[model samples]
Every structure is written in structure tokens, then in C-alpha cells.
Target chain A: MNDTDLNDLLHTAGRTDGTDSFDARADLARGRRALARIRRRRVAGGVLGLAVAGVIGTTAVREYAGDDTPTARQEQQSSSGVEAVRLVSQPLDAGSYRFGKVPDGWSVQGENAFRVTIAKDGDPDTHPDSFIGKLVIMLDSNAPAGDEVTHHNGREFWVNSDGGGDHTSISTLTRDGEPAGTILVQFPNDAGWAKLTMLEFLDSVEVLEGAQPSVG
Target chain B: MRATDRDAEFVEFVAEHRPVLMQAARLLTAGDHAQAEDLVQTTLTKLYVQWPKVRRSDNPVGYARRSLTHVFIDEGRRAFRSRERVVAEPPAPDARREEQVADDHELRASVLDALGGLPPRQRAAVVLRHWFDLDVDQTARILNCSTGTVKSQTAKALRHLRASLEPAVTLKEIP
Candidate 1:
């Protein structure tokens, strides 16, 4: 805590000879492999976000402090059909979850406090639009396989006419010890699994209280 | 040197500094050994790609630290789990594993717990100040903050850490 203690801890972080004097060859080589894993993250490629006319930009939003708060940095682009959508993304503030147990290629995304954003294997970009969009929304309320939250008379309804696939969505959503939502999705068959994933991610959006939806 | 030669040089650089980078990765990750190692490797890999330009920096070490943070953020694009942090122990005067490591383990656990209690910025400040021995300015560079911000963060971090440790220490009477 004191300078001395902090100094002592810093000293203990490593051996004396300085980091440049280290065997950087192996470290750099390993870095390449890790690069492959991180190359397509949300950083470099904004991905299919702008494509979905109904996109959630980080734009200015209602700010209020609470147990879980979101900071919006609104960004926008033109789409064929633009619908006002608000996005509230919080970092891993509380604590991130462990993925060593989850299936390979699956990741946890969105709210860091407690969340699970699943995308089909080998599909990185546009997942939120195709399947991930739909999944997150469906998780809030279970819909039969191939169902989308269709608004009928101001009520959100989960309906799937085509009998898409075995939709079993699994996620844990919590705020102040209360379950915000939960899901266990299974596709009827693997036919539209990939599409389902994208739609799920896109539709499965979490907007803050009173987020404006822009319509064009 | 040629591009290939430069790439080789960068690789050599990372091979050695892997452990130090691992230390940074270890803190960012919380305590995941494998992930820390992976992060170290990834940090070095980018340096290798831009070796020529990166090596030109007046501070190559700073370059590597920045690279590591970038890799961390990028990786979290998918998701990021914290790594386990290690608390260093002083060697016992006598050579006894049981007597030495037991307290060392307890002390290390307390230190990590204390670190977890701090906010992310404070944790980074404490880790940079104490673990890496970077001065306020250098730590600011690593954290991408002003030196004064680093100083305040260090102060706040120390306050929290001390508060966490005070209960364990007893006042000694000098007779």
C-alpha cells in the first residue's frame, strides 16, 4: 500500500535482469498464435452492425447511476431501413465469467457483470445480426423453435411459422440478485442453426430504459 | 537488416521478455497461467510483425506494454476472463518449505484478495507502481493517463491496500 510496499511488490514481479533481456523469441512466436484468436474481435471490424438498419449505436443515452450502469458512445450509419435502436454495453465491471468450461469457440459478450453471447462456431462477424441478435431476445422469453418476437398490437410475441429448428437458448442474466432473463435454446435440426444464431444475436439486444428507436 | 532479419530480431526480443510480459498479462488476467502466457505470446507476435517500426521506438519496453494492452482489449472483443495474480514471497532465513510457504501462501492470497477489491484503474496503478517499479510518468504512459492521474490512482490504491493489511500488523513497542 505504501510506496515501499508497492515498490517491494514491483520488485517481486520478476527477476532483476530487465524484460528486454528476456528470451523474447518464444514469447513473440506464441504471440502470433494468440493473434490469430484475437484478429477478428469487435475492435478492428465494426462487423455487420451498420448493416442491420435497426442497429444499436453507442450514441448519447439516458445516464443514471445504479448497481449496473451503461455508458453509451453513440455511433451511426445509414441502412436500407433504419429503425431506432439503443445500445447499452457495459464492460466486465463486476467480474467476467470463465470460458474454459464452456464449449470451444463460444464467447461471453455484452454486459460483463453477468452475460453469455454465443455465436456459431467459425462465424465471427454479423452474428449479432443473424442469430445472436434473435437469441438474446428470445432468451428473455422462451419462443418455440423458429420463432421471432413479432409485435402484435404493442405486445412482443414469439412466433415461428416455418418451424425453423430446435431452439434451445441458455444464458444467465442477473441484476441485484434478480434474474433479468434466462434461456436454454435447442434447434429442431441443424438446418438454420447458423442463420438462427445471427438473428438471435441481433434480436437479442438489451436497450436501456427509454432508449429511442430511430425510424426512417 | 532485412525484413526477415528484423522479424528474427523481434522474435528474439520476445523470447526473453516473455516472463516479464507474462507478469503484466498475469495481473490483467487475474491468475490464469495459460491465458497470461498466451497474452504474452500474442503481445510479442504483433511486435514481431511491426518489428522494424516498433524497434524504432525510444522505449521498446513501453511499446511491448502498449501492445499487450491492445491485445488484451482486442481479445476481449469476444470475451476476457481475469488472470490470477501472484504475490511474491521473501525467502525464509531457514530452509524449510512448510514453515516458509504456508505463510507465503496466506500472504499471497491476502494480497490478491486486496487487489481484487480495488477498482480496475487502481489495481493497474498499484500493479504498475509496485509490481513493475515504473515511476509515475512511466506508469502513466503504460496506462495512457496523465502523470498526476497516475499519482492520485497510486495514492488511492495504496490507501485501499494498506487498509486491507492494517489489521494483520500489530504495533511494536520499542523499549
Candidate 2:
């Protein structure tokens, strides 16, 4: 078609009638909620910055006091250890996929035969298609690539932090009979997902027969 | 601007421009009403989060439209990686009786189906250039590409549209 014809066609196709279902009120409410979420995140970030500054100050004071003894080192090591977040012992279903455990306060946002996305409760960005700040689980035939490999509970896990360091992907081979590909879980770094917890959660995913491998 | 003022302005902007944004989104999503609505919601929420920037922009509607395109492209990439697969055929068109003439609805369906078949960026190029009547430089700015790239993309999209819609609608050949 010529330019004018193409323009006319697009204009005709893009037209929306008065009967079009668009709720401006709901859009405003959602917008308000998103603004609230942004404010909360800012406050949380400020608090975290202050806490980090306090820890640094305290550590500097301790170092100035010649507290570098073996006993002090042991105490520091013990206190700085990451406390693994445990998943709740509950079964969750997302379409054809099933989860034996999930992090507390997290709920499934979207799912298909190929992938399932889980996000924190009360997350304002409820667009299932958006995976930012969420945990996504999928199966793919691509070989698992990671920075480190660790074995837990008879299953090997590959842990790779994304280039931005904002997210980590943990992948493990699916058990025989479920799917012949790797089951991968990518979790946001700020979501309180320790490597151990990620491994445990990935372990709990049961890829059903209907599950399809996600194409790259 | 003050918080209350910003909120009020944002609400007013949404009330005035949301329908226009929805129409653009409908074209971007190739006429999927539910998806178009979701895209609009996400775009509005993002705009709300950055209301100060929206207010500062010379054209808030243009800024929002740009944001909508970015969201659509982002979601399209994610969808490509996560769920896109080869479909053997497009969905069947509506059945028509021999006596019924193919109307605007049928033509609209044909156009949307063809638009949906184009890659997301190419489809976006077509929508921005044809539906929005944006010049090449403006389309390139929204797409964050060079003007030459916009021309080539629009050309390819037009060629595809010509081939796809010729049977359903009368059209002069595109040079």
C-alpha cells in the first residue's frame, strides 16, 4: 500500500469506540499505589544506608581499639554469617508447574507451560509480563552457565550473579522423567534470597509433563 | 512541584490523555484489547513514579508515549525470550457467508494480523510513522535509533504490509 493508504488503514485499525473498556479510575489508583511503592523503597534505602554507615563506624572503632585478636575474628565471622532465609512448607501451583516451597510473603504473579513468575506480596507492579523485582522459574535446554557450582542434597546447583549484580540465577538439572532440560530460577538480589534458599526453592520445583522448554 | 500538586496534575493528565495512550497501545499490541490496557496501566504507573520528569517535559503526552513504547519493547523482549515459539499458522479469520461483503472489521483484522507478524521494533516503527504521522527524526528519537535506521525499518514494514493487506484491501503499490 502507498503511504496514504497505509496511514488510513492504521488509523482505522487503531480507532477505539466509546464502548472501549478503559477504567481511568483504576488507572489512577494503580498509579497511586506505584507512587507509594516508590516512596517506601526510597525510605527503606535511606534506612539501609544509615545502618551501613553505623556498621562501618563501629567496625572502624573496633579496629582502632586493637580488637584484631583471633577471638575477635571468630566473633566477627560468627556475627557476619548470612542467615539463610527458609522457604515456607506449603504447596503452590502455577498453571502446570508446582512449587513445594516458596519464600514467605511471595506469591505467583504469572505462569504458563514454560515459565512461572513469583513476586513479593503487595507488589504494585502486578503486570504478570513484567519480571523485574520478581523470581522467575523456567526450563531451558541451554547449558547452565554460572560463576560457581555447589552441590546440596544430592543436586548440583550453578550460581551466577547477573552483570548488574541486581539478580542471581540458580540452575539445576531436572530430575529424570520430569523434563530433560535445566530448571532455572532467577531471583532478585534484594529479595532476601540466599544461595541456600534459592537452591532449596529450585529443588522444590516439579516440572510437570505439560511443561515446555522456554526458547531463548 | 508540591506532592499534592504533582498528584493532581498527574491525575488530570491521565484523565485527558489515557484514551490516546490506549489507542497507541492498541496499535502497539496489534489490537489485543486486554494487552493494550495492561500496557497503558504499566505506562501510567511508570509515569506516575516519574511525575516530576513528566511535568518538566515540554510535552508530557509525548513523554508518556515514549515511555509506553519503551515498556512495550521491554515486555516484547522478555516475551521473546521466555515464551515465544513458532506458531504453525495464524488464528483463523471470522467465518463469513457468501452474501456478506468484507467490511471494515475484516479489513481491520487483516491489518492487525499482518502488523502482529512484524517484529516488535518494525511494528512500532510502522505504528509511529503511519498511525502517529511522526517524521523520520521523531520516530528515530522515540526508537532511540538513527534516522537512517528508522527509514529502513519503516520501508521494510511498509513492504510487508503491502504484501499482507493487498488481498483484503485495495492499495496502490508502494515505491
Candidate 3:
């Protein structure tokens, strides 16, 4: 068959019954809800920015005021020496991959043999294949390329930031007796993940035999 | 744009263009109406979030089409991967001897089944190039790939379609 014939077939298959069942009003409602959600996120981000700025300003004022009292010094130490976030020892399963520990408030959303997506507890978008604002883990044959390398638990992990430094991807070689490829995890930079905690989580993953390497 | 004004324009746009968008999405999802609707809803929500940009574009409908296509290509990957199926079994020898003819519904099912079997990018190439009547460069722009890549993908898709549909469809040869 020629192009016209093929096009005809596609049109025929795509044709809907003439009932006009599409609900434009419903779409409008959904759109408004999404817009509200976007606005809320922007507001929350702005608030967080202000809080960080306030902390910096307070620190500078204290330094200029020569407030060297023990209590003030302890408060400054506490503020400057914020504890690094760590993963909890709770087991989580995503398809053939298993995580010995994950950061609090994250759970597996969906997974196939190729990749597993984990998202925060309150993420509105539930689509597993949509990776935005989620953590995606996959196994691939590509060599790990990143700006920094860190050795942890006898494995080397290559770390890189993408999406204009908003996202971070860390790749490391899978352990022996499992898939022979790089296992990579990608997460947003502001998702409250410290570099050491991310490394610990990556070290905890176990790639089973059913795992398959993703293709480009 | 003010909130109420933007919303009015968005509602109007959806009312006018949703049917065409749904048709395009049905083709993209290989006749899966449920998934097609989900794709349309997601696309419309995205367009609504960026309503100012949509209104500024010279062709709002075209912009919506491009967004629908991108959403299909991006988030529909896993769905398409799971939906892939083997080609239908060939007709029996006796039926072939008698020159089997299929009705419109049967032909459409066969075509959609074949289309569903293609890899995602190849299927997108066919839908954009043939179903949407887009030029190679236009398809490449929407697909975010080079024109040479578009030509190669479309060629591969056409080859697959011909091979799969030849036994199912017996159209007259064009001179």
C-alpha cells in the first residue's frame, strides 16, 4: 500500500464516534487545579529562599555585634553545623531491584525491568514514567561520566549535576553475580539528599538477575 | 494576562481544538481510547499552566498539537513498551487461495495492531509524517531530532507497516 492508503487506514482507526463526549469544562477544571498547584509550589520555593537568606543575615549581624556569649556561640555552631541527612534502614522493593535503605518519606512509585521510579510522599503527579520531581534508578551499559568521583563501601561512584544544576545523577558499577553494568540513580538537587546519604543509598541497592540494561 | 481572562481563553481553546487533539492522540496511543484521553488531559493541563505562552503563539492549535506529541513521546514510553504485541497469525492456506477480503473494522484493527508493534520513535515518526501530513523538517522539529533522523525513522516505519499489512490488506497497486 502507498502513503495515501496508509494515511486512510490511520484516519479510519483514529476516528471517534460522533457523540462529542469530550468535556471541555472538565479539562478547564483540571487546568485550574494544576495552575493552583504550580502557584503553591512557587510560593513555597520563595518562602524557602527567604528563610535561607534570613539565616545568613542573622549570622552576619551576630558576627558584627561581637556576641561571643556561650549560648550565642552554641547557637551559631548549631546553625552552621547542620547535621547531614541520612537514610533509614527500611527495606524497599522496586521490581527486580531492592533497596536496603532509603531516605525517609520516599517510596517506590513504579518499576519495570528497565527502570524504577521513586517519588516523594506528596507528589501530585503519579505517572511513573514522568521522572520530573522523582528519583529514577536504572541499569545501563554506558560508562559513568561525571565531574566528581567518590569511593564508598569498596565501589566508586561518578556524580554529575544536570538540568542546570537542579538534578544530580550518580552511577556506579553493580556488584558481582548481578548485572554487569552501571547502576545509576538520578534525583533533584533540592530533594534534601546529601551527597553522603545518596552514596549510602546507592550502595544499598541490589540488582537481581531479572534486571535488564536500558537502551538509548 | 489576568486569571479570569486567561481561563476564559483556555476554555475556548479547549472547546475548539480538543476533538482534533483527541484524534491525534488516539493515533499516537494506537487506538487506546483511555490512554489517549489521559494523554490529552495531561497535555491540556500543561497548556493551561503555560497559557500565556499558548496565547502568544501565532498558532495556538499547532502549539497544542506539538505539546500532545511531546507528552506522548516522553511519558508514554513505558505504556507503549508494555503494549507491544506480535503480528497476527497469517491467514489459512485455503483462505489465501480464495483471496481473503477484510471489512473496514477488521482492516482497521489489523492496521492498529501492526502500528502498535512498532517501536515508539518509529510509530511517532509515522503519526507525525503521515497522519498529521507534516514535512520531514517539521516532524524533526517537533520530535527534537535532525531531519536525516526523521527520514530514516519514517522510512523504517513505512517498511514495517508494508510488510505487516500486505497480507492483511490487498489494495490495488498505484500506477
How many clashes would you count in candidate 1? 71
Best by DockQ: 3
Tens-place lDDT digits, model 2, residues A1-216? 223377777877788767675566677688889778766876997799697776645544553364766754443332336222447779988966789987878888888886788888899988665667888888865566564678988989887663234578888888888868888887877665655567878999888888887533
Sort by DockQ, top down from the best: 3, 2, 1
TM-scores, each model vs. reference: 0.43, 0.54, 0.56
Model 1 chain B weakest 10-residue run by lDDT: B166-175
Higher-lDDT candidate of 1 and 3: 3
Each candidate's fnat: 0.27, 0.48, 0.52
User: Looking at model 2 chain A, which ten-residue stretch has the lowest summed lDDT?
Assistant: A75-84
Which pairs clash (backbone N, Cα, C closer than 3 Å) in model 3?
Answer: none
Query: How do the residues B87-112 of candidate 2 rate in per-residue lDDT, one tens digit apiece?
Result: 46654553441112155665666777
lDDT of model 3, residue A167: 74
Highest lDDT model number: 3
Rank ordering of all candidates by TM-score, starting from the highest? 3, 2, 1
Off by over 4 Å in 2: A1-4, A54-216, B81-102, B173-175
User: For every model in order, what is the number of clashing pairs?
Assistant: 71, 0, 0
Which ranges in model 1 have alpha carbons more than 4 Å from their true place? A1-4, A13-216, B1-3, B70-102, B169-175
Q: Worst 10-residue stretch by lDDT in candidate 3 chain B?
A: B94-103
**What level of docking quality does candidate 3 show?**
incorrect
> Which of 1 and 2 is the better model by TM-score?
2
